[model samples]
Target: MTSDKTELNDAELSRYSRQILLSDVDYDGQLTLTQSHAVIFGLGGLGSPAALYLASAGVGKLTLVDFDQVDDSNLQRQVIHREANIGQDKVASAKTNLQALNHHIEISTVATKLTEAELADLVAMADVVLDCTDNFESRFALNRQCRRHGVPLVSGAAIRWEGQLTTYDFRQAETPCYQCLYKEEQGQELTCSQNGVLAPVVGMVGSMQAIEAIKVLLTLPTLMGKLMIMDAHTMQFRTLNLPKDPDCKTCRD
Candidate 1:
């Protein structure tokens, strides 16, 4: 199921014709996408759309990680899972749908929370990692791993009517890790179950995460050191610079 093709076959060209039409994602870019691997850590609101787009866009392989099972309450925003999958593991549900979307791509699922060592192994294998996970603990753990492996990380979050998106291209010396933006002590994690969220807000942020991931694989310009904030209520979007923390424990030399 692994893709190591340097040239796109006729079927692939037709399947991704629209994307290949873009000057930036021409034949070469499309081929690059088909040869890339992405690891996603979550299958809820944010991970759902992010996984969908990456699969449809022809990322060669995707590793979905989520220990939670599909719940009735998740239907409102976790679009990749269906009502029939209510009791299924989130990663399993996501794998089924993503494969249905693109059988040409390889999809793997991890139905358990990964230990730091396990997480590091996966991050080291990925061309890009999407931090669709919730909670500061998971975010900080992933940030440290991505920094250690020098893999780009696309992090997104949505709670209530606000959403945030950022990329940490760890391959670059000056890029900031997640800890640089929000200290561990500053994390007062909020959840949709507790605070409630507008469904489309997560969809928007997750979709943007997909875009940034593709850009990373293509070596195109991305929000590497910038954070994008969205207020769905006001329908306004803002991008701010995210500078590196010289004292960042995970990324500081």
Candidate 2:
């Protein structure tokens, strides 16, 4: 028996029957996901898995922004890029994986990195932003754009089995911006190159990142205004309920 609660037709049903079975997405939730646009930055260790799941879960449009190319070292954590795709652009490699996961969604890729101006322009065009970049420069730049545009952001980071996930919604008073947690001068203190992250851990964190992004777009309950950290060694989870810093240059703006 078909219910009027779903937006997917017979084809989509045949493709995502399992998901549709869940009461959460009987029909309307699935349609919301299939109609929203999510912009992901970096497309590396963390962004790779996030983009993959976002596309698979039927996020209407996936915009990938990256300026790097695939490398043999990237295969250790960049699940979306294969050994055979070593020399190709990371954005292109990501698109291939995203399409293979779900051909129904529109995959938009920017093989070039988004400059300050470019990032602002793209943020304006997207409903949500995912800060998956490894470098602080890009992360800060993206965070600034998210603030100026008042866009919801899901930021995730992973390194050597240590990972963090947080959501920012300036629309809500007292929400902490990325700057509140990681000050600018700290820089790329923990990069995959130096810290050496586990491949699966990156996948785990990135997958969660995607889940958070989906929740935000779906207007579903999520870890908004909270910082969640995970450690693989002790298998511990910590929730830090911190208030927005009044001096935060990004959010306080």
Candidate 3:
């Protein structure tokens, strides 16, 4: 399963039997998933569920990136980190949990912040990049790198019962990127630590990210030019079209 060949073993077939049952993710789609590589940035609320679902769904390789350590506070929303792993680096804890969930997949961890060049290199090698990072700076950096590398990015953010999910398929000439929707000049960024977020809110967004990542790998329809916003407080969901900004600094060429 690690080589260029894409074949599912009997065990793999059985393990992903439920997913393979779907016409959307049939045998071919499952094999595509097994041959795909997904890079996840941030191991907190969003990254936690995204990584878990991706691993359980049998994405062949996962690169988990996070520079922070797990805090006791993170356990409230970051389900991948156990109480015992509170002091451990987030990438290390996430890898431990992900491997325990599915040992057949390859899980790599980067426990430090990456420079621009380094991030670009990683993005270039990924089939899809999951932007679960908490801040605007990281999100902006990831968006630029993904756009430069022409990799699909599944971006999710949740703070204070509100969450948003979107995908940018940089391979598409007209796809809207993160920078198209947000400007770095908008300096006041809200965080769960500063505000507050329901555990399930981020979980939902992260799970959707996993779904989008798998869809991107399988060449299925995705939310490439749409943003899905969820108001957990009101239990409402709205989707809006995201047009590419010709003036966007990152994607405007």
List clash counts for every candidate, in order: 0, 2, 0
| Top-down lDDT ranking | 1, 3, 2
Give residue 45's error in model 1 in angstroms: 0.3
> Per-residue CA lDDT of candidate 3, range 146-251, in tens?
8888999999999988999999998899899998999989779987888999999999999999999999999888999999999999999999999998898887
Instruction: Give one digit per residue, the lDDT tens place, for model 1 in 1-253.
Output: 1366879988999999999999999999999999999999999999999999999999999999999999999999999999999999999989988888999999988998788889889888999999998899999998998888889999999999999999999889989889999888884789888999999999999999999999999999999889999999999999999998889877764
- 37 in model 3: Cα distance from truth in Å? 0.3
Cα lDDT, all candidates: 0.92, 0.83, 0.92
Candidate 2's TM-score reads 0.93
Residue 31 C-alpha lDDT in model 3: 91
Where is model 2 more than 4 Å wrong at Cα? Answer: 1-6
lDDT of 2 at 149: 85
Error of 2 at 1 (Å): 29
Instruction: Give the range of the ten consecutive residues with the poorest summed lDDT in model 3.
Output: 1-10
Off by over 4 Å in 1: 1-3
Candidate 2 per-residue lDDT, tens place, 1-253, comes to 1122346777777877777688876677778788788999888988988988888888888889888899898888888888988999999988987788888888888987557888788898887899899878877888888888888889988889888889887456666888888889764476778868888888888999999888787677778778999998788999888667888877767
Candidate 1: lDDT over CA atoms?
0.92
